[model samples]
Target: MGVGLYLHFPFCQQKCNYCDFNSYAGMEHLLPKYLSAIKQELFLYKVHVSVVNSIYIGGGTPSLLAINDITTLFDSIRRNFYVADRAEVTMEVNPGSCTLEKLKVIKMNGVNRLSIGLQSFNNESLKKLGRIHTVEDFIRTYQYARQAGFDNINVDVIYGLPWQTGEEWQDTLAGVVELDPAHISLYSLTIEEGTPFGRELKAGKIKKIDEDLEAEMYENAVKLLKANGYEHYEISNFAKPGKRCLHNQIYWRNEEYVGIGAGATSYMGRVRYTNVKEIPLYIEKVFGNDYATAEKEALKLDKIIGETIMLNLRLLDGFRMDDLTKRFKTNIDQLYGPTIKVLSNQGLLKEEAGMLKLTDHGLMIANQVFQRFV
Candidate 1:
């Protein structure tokens, strides 16, 4: 199988309160130099670039780049790698960062998909989350994307926000249904330890929504999106039929992928590697001037099996008995029999047609079920 490519753009107009991605708040001036560094890095691995089937440009805000910058970057990719003619090319954008003109330019440059971040539509919630766009911004951006000839798009929404009302949650879902994006990613809000939200939480200035309320909101989201014709393929992602994120499915399927840029991770064969988190150091290393890798770890068979189970279990189709056997060189029943039995007995999981899947109850208590694998 061909490896997917992920390029991280660690620059955003403003960092969100809950975000802990290696993205920076400002650094537009460094783009030219950064682009050069990325291209230089691409050149170094040019020989290993022939098997790419998908290229995802994710970010602090990839849409912050001028159309010309994106065009140049795409040109460099073509010059250095062999991308399939129908490769899924996706770019992540914040609603506040794009113009119709820029979007059109993006389409012309071979970007076939756009994942727009519209965390919430309610003005109060947007402010609370520190989003730069209003609901109107997301609406206009959707309109422009349609006009600019983009047929595939994913809109991201977050539930479980602090102080979010149930009514507000329903209203956001209603608004998203009206927009009718091809794909939707509904994520629960989590407070990572180093984020601003985390700090506020530790200081007791902010509160997490009650677990029961969070679950209710998530249930509401699933019902609303399904009624609007979205398929719940993964826990946090839904899509209109046949429009599920292909590149993402590659990860859920436990396939190999290569990551480029600061803090990006790559998993190929048995090797897992990440680039330096600092831009200057990343550039230096890419230019053969230093050896500053942020992290690298080689996996053994047990870790690989655990990781494969962890990732694949997130999908609706669940794990395959045959594939697990082949990959781990162990009988699936013999290795995980006890854990599987316990989960099945608890009605959290079941085996059907030779694949294991979560029951509706299991999906809610998924973390507990997954922990048994470790």
Candidate 2:
């Protein structure tokens, strides 16, 4: 019953070509500005979250900061909010930048979870993704995190890259499974319109992998991870029992969380809001002690129910129709019964043990299911 807190660290050693998130390179001069502004923004929202169950420090690359500044950020959170004793405090680290000493200080400052970006086991794949670190760097970073006493860690990887053969994908899956990290995130590459990948694709310089191959890659991930005892809790995330990312679950479950820093998002009281995407504008507003909401919308009536169905369905366990009925005080059958019946008949949805959930087929074409609700 605790709130979740998300902090964005916008610094990066170098921006990846596939990334469109509001992270910056050559921004060392702005680090002090970001830190000061982030603290003020936290204070602005201090009234909402008194007890936090999770805190995630994500970024262009959060590990790019000095350990002392990272500690200060955590300290500011504690100074303003009461983090639960066992809260999942996580920080995202890139393989290139993390060091043993820094990880130890991060642990000492109360980070219990570490998420390392290890996009692939193959050096060529890593190069294609514009990752600065090599396979050996990831191995060293992982070992150091363990030596620093991190038992819970997550590794991030991507599939569906150009020239990624099935054999290569299988080799990657085998390597990652052998490591047995607490969590793994398997993402499909998405080429955003303004990114380098996008331009290359538009110019016929790069080609996407076959759709069938992409689907098979996902299938392989699900099969291999589950066979190894990792629960496919979310479409992209696999975790050992009782180790699902509490912070990200706050997102998938559509619960309330406050986000701090540029381009961050927040959801609370049935309202969703986003901060300024540009760092300079975000820093200016927050440092001036003003609210940094660049866009906001209050979800009510149909919007709330629609959003609930869309988000909660992402969880494998799914949400109960009865709870949705009680919360919004409407009969679920009256509102969505026909849509449900049609989808169930199409083999995309099923109701079991009084809960409505997407079938494996549904997860494969999850967008179709979402479209029905909207």
Q: In terms of TM-score, which candidate is strongest?
A: 2
Please give the distance, in angstroms, between residue 105's alpha carbon in candidate 1 and its true position after superposition: 1.3
After TM-score superposition, the amount by which residue 114's alpha carbon in candidate 1 deviates from its true location, in angstroms, is: 0.7
Which residue window of length 10 is worst by lDDT in model 2? 299-308
lDDT string, candidate 2, 73-108, tens digits: 888899999989989999999998989999999999
- Report residue 211 deviation for candidate 1 (angstroms): 0.6
lDDT of 1 by residue, 101-161 (tens): 9999999989999999998889888888888899999999989999999989999999899
Best by lDDT: 2
CA RMSD for every model? 1.5, 1.1
Instruction: Let me know the TM-score candidate 1 reaches against the reference structure.
Output: 0.96
lDDT agreement of model 1 with the native:
0.86
- Residue 126, model 2: lDDT of 87
The residue-level lDDT of candidate 1 at 176 comes to: 86
